[model samples]
Target: MRYLYSLLLLCSIVLWSSCRNDFETEPSTGNLQFSRDTVYLDTVFSNIGSSTYNLKVYNRSDDDITIPTIQLAGGESSNYRLNVDGLPGKSFENIDILAKDSIFVFIETTANIENFSNENQFLLTDAIEFDTGANQQKVELVTLIQDAVFLYPEKFDDGTTESLSFGFDEEGNEILIEGFFLDETELTFTNEKPYVIYGYAAVPGNRTLNIEAGARVHFHEASGIIVAQDGSLHVNGMLSNDQETLENEVIFESDRLEPDFSEIPGQWGAIWLTAGSTNNLINYATIKNATVGILTESNDGTSNPTLTINNSKIYNSSNAGLLARTGHVKGNNLVIGSAGQSSLSLSLGGQYNFTNCTFANYWTGSYRSLPTVLVQNYLETPEQIFVSDLIEANFNNCIIYGNENRELVLNERSEADFNARFENCLIRYNDFGFGSQGYDFDDETLFPGTIINVIPNFYNPQENEFMIDEESGANNLANPSTATNQDILGTPRGSSPDSGAYESIIFPEED
Candidate 1:
């Protein structure tokens, strides 16, 4: 058949010349071996975008090279941004790299700082380079940026978009909200720089906001801080008098400055306070991760306490670290910790008063079905059935522990009014199930001088560290004049007081 078609065209030309001699055009004499000549990319926040940073590039010699130029020394007017191996670049060519193989690059940044004018942080640099065959390499990158106070949400022209306004709707009608109201000169927030929000920032009814004291805010992703109704939000974080320094506190988190997002729980939203917002304070401050760290709502029976936390610390909340629907809150040296549901939820009920607080919840990030203080009153939807009136839910010298086994929960609801109280507290709850509709740590008149299922040696409930171990059983049980004679780091508290917000201070074991 014509000599088998010339032996199938000479075996397809010897398999395309043995696949072009198994690739390897040589041409690189640079000896490239980087995995980090200078990546840094840390602080970010002027125009935001960051967090990719990689590098690799090894090819430890065995031939196959070719890199003639990979560069971005500010190439396309760079503000940093590259990709390289998967191409998306500021410049690249030849590339290839086989024999001892390795090649990644990544890097990212956003930085705009309105042409940066020398102030609240601003470094940003760049380099990359590489060119081969005649040698030339480099890497460096750096970052820093900062310059915040962003806030967002405002897009009128009929396309509608202002944000932050859940105002009226319990039959008082008038509801049509959706944010945007600040004005009182943007409401305060000072401590020199970092703010960043990006959506719900409301506060308008009678306006208040404040913030100051080393402020740092952040937010983003589902942002927060509402307030409205009669509005007010204070925050003042103050301590410095040898309290070993939380500098000046005030740090609401999550704009993700990445360390794998620190303790990453809900990453933002909540700090609401709504229902006719009243006094609202929040001293020393810390409020972390979010999605409910201070919700509030319900108050209208005002007696001057609609919120008044002090020496604050709400931690990684994925739901409630102090929610209080029928609100009236009033903490003191508080501490709240990890919570995928309740670390103090007092739902649909009002008037709560913690003191030397510390509600701990060893939530290892997932599967935490409630409890760490819940006390409810009523809430059945399907179109109406609300009920509220928890009239007074106290908890002096508190320490309600958690890691479940019933860490306190009382959902009452036979037509409202659940009135609570648990003095000299330390309850880790073992459900002493009392009649008339639940709750009874052996009812010593509703848990007076309460201690129940004890074990508050804390000092590190898996690191949320609710400081207390001096062979704690909440040592000296508290009530030295209703606790708080210092603690929350200001130390003192001695004539027999140590219960929760820290006051065990011994130190001295460091051979």
Candidate 2:
């Protein structure tokens, strides 16, 4: 009798479960609230995909409401895409929102450049339609797309990407690099539309790639410009009248034009000047979002500096802003900030001369082990430590300060001459309980009139603002003989100039 009762109870439970309506919802009223009336996506390159944006749909009434339809107004043939709640589609049906609750809708897009015709910017529009008939409601979608000069390596029939012939590995194996050489006829980058490069663009061995003033160059992930053996690169940028309109400054940065990525570090690879590349010069340029801003690899034989850069800013680098491994580099009125590692690294033995420059590394990324400025004359390998003579590492009228206790590090080896000097500079350095390897503040020859362990009082180093405040330790202390007459922004530095890349001034409204 007990077994018979159990069986009857199981059958009753199954019948009740099957009769329940899990998806029951009430019809929404004509009033539907949205987080925004119009969703404006950030500007994007024609063929590039945009970042995902979201919208909130609120059911303010005290009832579980069902939206009959949520869709793009362009129907099935729109450049935009939508994801209602959790499901992705051009249109959705029967989306339910609980009482006093909200559901999210995600939107993204990729438009074609041809549809834009000759217009500098094309406005693409669409709408998300909810319900139908008298209960219809909509939220508009808009985006401004720009035409770009896209250059990428060819894809093969086998679905493999193209690779350039890099020299060889230590074992004589051919090293193929994922890149392409620009056509000889199109070596010059003009001030037309922005250039979007997909991979490393190699300059031909004997050719030069000239980037004109106001030319904007964008590099995709892991992409950059590489100068081949004996090749040269010249960035001819002029100073702009308005500081805000850095219009004439040649800008090199990541392809993501969105404001959120402006100070994000390590978006692309370095502007690599290969071993034999020579006479690379850059002026009035702004290079940002690189693993290493400029990597000059061992152009040691030439008396002339491998790179001569002036009035330039290098920011948000993962590694060193200006890294010269056994090479020569000359810089003036340069500002480098927020590098994960050293902001100015003259490492593995190099010849460097920097005047009126700022190396302020307020790195917010992972913990940094190195200082803001590091001058090392040795490279340690697993097998052994190799020491090279650091011919000269001179910093005149400069500022090397950061969040670290020690912003300047000098690493030397007994076998090599690690010659370095600092003159009339404001350097942030504290003598640790454990001694600084080769630090001597009393030596006038090595450190002439240098201010130690003092705040340069940068406007805001964390935000990549290197301009010094009026009450800064760097004011009126520069060695004028070695300093640049003009600041990075083309502001004239008086005879008694402030140190670092910028001259302290009474700012606009502050005056």
lDDT of each: 0.82, 0.89
Give the runs in model 2 whose Cα sits over 4 Å from its true position: 1-17, 507-511
Cα displacement (angstroms), candidate 1, residue 299, comes to 6.8
Give the Cα error of residue 265 in candidate 2, in Å: 1.0
- Model 1 off-target regions past 4 Å? 1-25, 28-49, 55-68, 73-77, 81-98, 103-106, 113-183, 187-253, 257-263, 266-288, 295-320, 323-343, 347-363, 366-373, 376-511
Per-residue lDDT tens digits for candidate 2, residues 339-422, read: 989998886887889999999999988999999998899888887887888999999999999998988988888888889999
Which pairs in model 1 have colliding backbones? 163-178, 163-179, 163-180, 164-178, 164-179, 165-179
- Choose the strongest candidate by TM-score: 2
Q: Write the per-residue lDDT of candidate 1 for residues 177-295, one digit (tens) a residue.
A: 44567787889999888898876788887779999887889888788888878888999988856444466888898887867787887888888887898888889988888888888
TM-score of decoy 1: 0.36
Lowest lDDT sum, 10 consecutive residues, model 1, at: 431-440
Q: How many backbone clashes does candidate 2 have?
A: 0
